[model samples]
Target: MVVTHRGAQAVGRCLEFGCGTGHLTRALVDRLSIADLALNDLVGDCEPHVMARLPAGQRARFHAGPVERLDPEGTFDLIASASVVQWIPDHRCLLRDLSNRLEPGGWIALSGFGQDQFGELQALGSSASAPGYRNAGDWAAMVPQGMALMATRQIQTRMYFPTVRAVLRHLRETGVNGNAQGGWSRARLQKFEQDYDAQFGTAQGLPLTYDAVWMLARKI
Candidate 1:
């Protein structure tokens, strides 16, 4: 969607924050004409995984650290991230910072979760949500100065699990294990499983929701 929106012009430089496992990096490199690509992630070990995803000779610079503290040289023609903005505590500030790094006419594309991301977990009083969960309307209001909000979209999808234990395992493997504090005694675990099943189970399985929001903006 973002590539289509930005048209077919080649980008001079592109920066992708939260390039976890290079999912978005591979997609962008495959579809966009980018002269330079920079990838950033909080985990230093993720560098190799992202690097390996690139085509044999395609070059990219990897920056390992919190993107908020990253100070890459020069401005970029595009700044993009996928499913990451929600982890930011102050997305408005990050938006302003990202906008400042954009060359005039540069574009920013981001996808994150809305307030209902983990609906089932949230309903069960889980603290598995990231800090900056904003809906489409909320994201529009977050556009910083010198930038225009071009588009925003929201999508909701549900994944079914065979059991509540499976749901918890899914969360752990997907890096959303914030709800897995150490206080879960065996009895408490059993009670939680029972309650979750009673409240949200279906003939197929238990449902977990993912509410994703996408935003695109351009520097004025």
Candidate 2:
């Protein structure tokens, strides 16, 4: 969710999709004095936090829903997203829609995890009978045929923890461990933690690896 590049520095409207808890949105509002700033997320509860973080008198609007449901009135100069797009079931249609909505020469900056992200956790999930994880190559293939790719990079980050309990706590606070289908049973939870520890825990502790992909492109 870092701003890897700053283009022309022009004053125009900017939109951020999937601005979770306004972390990146606040950064953009502080850095760019644009005519308008729009923030959108699938949930509505983020409005108050986003409002508080924005500077006084900045033109701001919040949209709460799936991206396809958003009916933006006009084209935007820049459309950015981070750590969010991978969850959508139909990313291709979403990207095509974004391309259609962007003005000519407008930029799209997106960052998300690849298949290698949380490989150990994924292995554990697979062992438990869950499936369907996408990698960076899967996302690239979903991009429409004509979009011009400006840049792409994948970085690996490994977080070492003192114990498996600490790792699980981090995931819980981050809301990264929830199952979309339903809640887990007590026995299932115990088994999952035990399996994870048995397979990946080291004498030093546990190591969690995240393979993140950052991409920038133009609508053309």
In candidate 2, the residue pairs with backbone N, CA or C atoms under 3 Å apart (3 or more residues apart, or in different chains) clash, namely: 115-135
Worst lDDT run of 10 residues, candidate 2, spans 126-135
Whole-model lDDT, model 1: 0.89
Candidate 2 structure quality by residue, lDDT tens digits, 1-220: 2244545476487889888788878777776677888889888998888778887898989999977889878988788887876666677787788888788877777877777767777677633111333564565676776677777778888898887567767766775434422456788878877887788888767888877877777766
Tens-digit lDDT track for model 1 on 1-220?
6777789778899999999899899989888888899999999899999999998777689999999899989999999999888889798899999999999999999999888888888888877778888998897778898999999999999999998788888888887545554577799889989989999999989999999899999999
State in Å the error of residue 188, model 1: 1.3
lDDT agreement with native, every candidate: 0.89, 0.73
**Model 1 collision count:** 0
lDDT value, residue 18 of candidate 2: 84
Give the lowest summed-lDDT range of ten residues in model 1: 175-184
